[model samples]
Target chain A: MVDDNTLLERRNVVKKIVDHRGNAKIITGLGSPTYDVFDAGDSHSNFYLWGGMGGTAMIGLGLAMSIPDTPIIVITGDGEQLMGLGSLASIGVQKPNNLAIVVLDNGHFGETGMQKSHTSYGINLCKIAEASKFEFFFDVVSNNDLENLIEILPPVKGPIFANIRIKSQNPPRKLPILDGVELKNRFRKNLGVEPL
Target chain B: MKVDDIQNNWEEKLFSLLLDHKIDFLPYVPDAGHAKLIALAEKNKLLKPVVLTSEEEGVAFASGSWLGNKKSVLLMQSSGVGNCINMLSILSKCNFPFVTLITMRGEFGEFNSWQIPMGQATKKTLEAMGIIVHRATHPSDVCPLVDAALYGAFSSDQQIALLLSQRLIGKKKW
Candidate 1:
């Protein structure tokens, strides 16, 4: 269980996770997850979702299934995850070994104004994921747990779900390329696919 | 031949056409109309079939598969099309190649009144989302239309919908 006062910083956690990323493709959910990913330094491998709120995990699943040799991670928020709760079941059924989902849970919907989210009201995402039959489930709260998560992330056979409890502080936004076409082209180009 | 046997044959042909087009990902929400196709995909090793919780996930799944330099197709009923509208915008805006095969309800002696609204609107709604729509009212028309949709989607990076009329799939017994 995470103490309300000792929450992790979203940006720092994002930076640590992304810094260790090697040849791994990333898909970020809307709002803070996108901002945190961009703040970590942009990459052509990163597909940032500007408006598709609940579609992040499915996109990750598709990518993982298509390119089974590559590692794919979906970084999203609790609000976004809740909106597409059914995706967890789908992912569990597929059980893609190359896919990982990291939820930066701040217990609030930061984008729609910091209103209390379902996580704040005792909705345990880890339990839902476990029930959905995720291979690994972790409720990350401390720096040591984050370190363990980073170490195990790359080689971890998933679908793994990790919920990192974050603070309710709004960080300065670092927006990435919002042009959908450009983002798509760059991501494809990185994968050595010719753009249409 | 019995009607069910004839329908199964057509479904097998459709599956083979999809395989011929190199569609590696098959994401769908379960529908009775798509049962034959779904079962074929599940047993085939080459096809990576995923059972989506909702129709919108299939949209995202196809888009992501395309991003990974692979081709994918979505299978859903007409009623589920409404759930995919907003997510479909992502495909059109990005000009990502997308192809969906829809089994239509509420057309040609539809018994359920609930299916009529979405069934009638499926074509217009898809067109409004910038998807080129094609309909097949007979089993003979299914292959060629699906082939055309696959070609247009991959070659021109266009979103295409292939709607299979209820008249072809047969009306629900209930």
Candidate 2:
């Protein structure tokens, strides 16, 4: 059990996730997930969602299937994941080997005034993913677990899922380029793809 | 059913057109009307056929495929169109190319009362999301409308919907 005071910080966890990403295209769910990814560091590869709530992981699936050689990671929050719960089963069926989803389970909707979310009330995301057929799902509780994840993450054949319990606290907003077209163009251009 | 109700080979024609347009990813929720087309798409080695958990997932799936330099067309029934409303924002905001073929219900010979509301509202709902709506009530109308839609989407980044009228598909026996 993760103690309240000792839970891994959201900011640090996001940073570690980004640090080990290794040329993967990252998609963030709305609100804090976007902020967390932006706060980690901006990149041409990061597709930050200012509004699409549950679409992040599905985006990773599509991109992973499109460019099979490139890795795709989606970093989202518990609330957004809950909203798009069906996507887990969808992605599991397709089973893209290069796609991974990392959920920062802060147990509340941090952006919407910290309303208690389903994960706080015992909605187990890892079990859900396992049932959905994710072969490499982990509930990351400690730094050691995160380190173990980091070492295996980039090269691991996924449909991988990781739910990390973090402190439910608001960090300073690190907004990325809010222009959706600009973000889309930059992300595509980064992959040598002309803007569509 | 009309004298010309049984249209021959339209699904095959549409699938060939998709291949001609270089659409490589096909994300769909199962619908009986789309079975033949989905099968043809699955047979293509270059095409990736993704079965979405729900309709909303396909919208973002198409957007992401576009972001990664691939083309995708979403297929769903009118009932699922309601599910895709919010997710279509991903296409509108990013101006991603979208082309969807919707097999309509609650239009001509619908027996299912539960399918009524969203089925009746499908075109308007899509229009509200800034998508251009086209309906093919007959077999001859489908490929031409979809050909234009493919051009409209990929060539100019437009969101286009091709609704296959339930009449053309024949009413469900049940």
User: Residue by residue across B53-133, what tens digits does model 2's lDDT show?
Assistant: 899999999998988888999999999999988999989899999999999988887878888998999999999999999
lDDT of 1 at A55: 92
Top candidate, metric DockQ: 1
Residue-wise lDDT of candidate 2 within A107-138, one digit each (tens)?
A: 99998899999988888999999999987988
Cα lDDT tens digits for candidate 1, A45-145: 99999876799999998999888888998999999999889999999898888888999999999988999999999999999999988888889999988
Which residue segments of model 1 deviate by more than 4 Å? Answer: A1-3, B1-8
Worst 10 residues of 1 chain B by lDDT: B1-10
- Model 1 has a DockQ score of 0.80
Q: Tell me how far the alpha carbon of residue B45 in candidate 2 is from the true structure, in angstroms, after superposition.
A: 2.2
Predicted structure 1: lDDT: 0.89
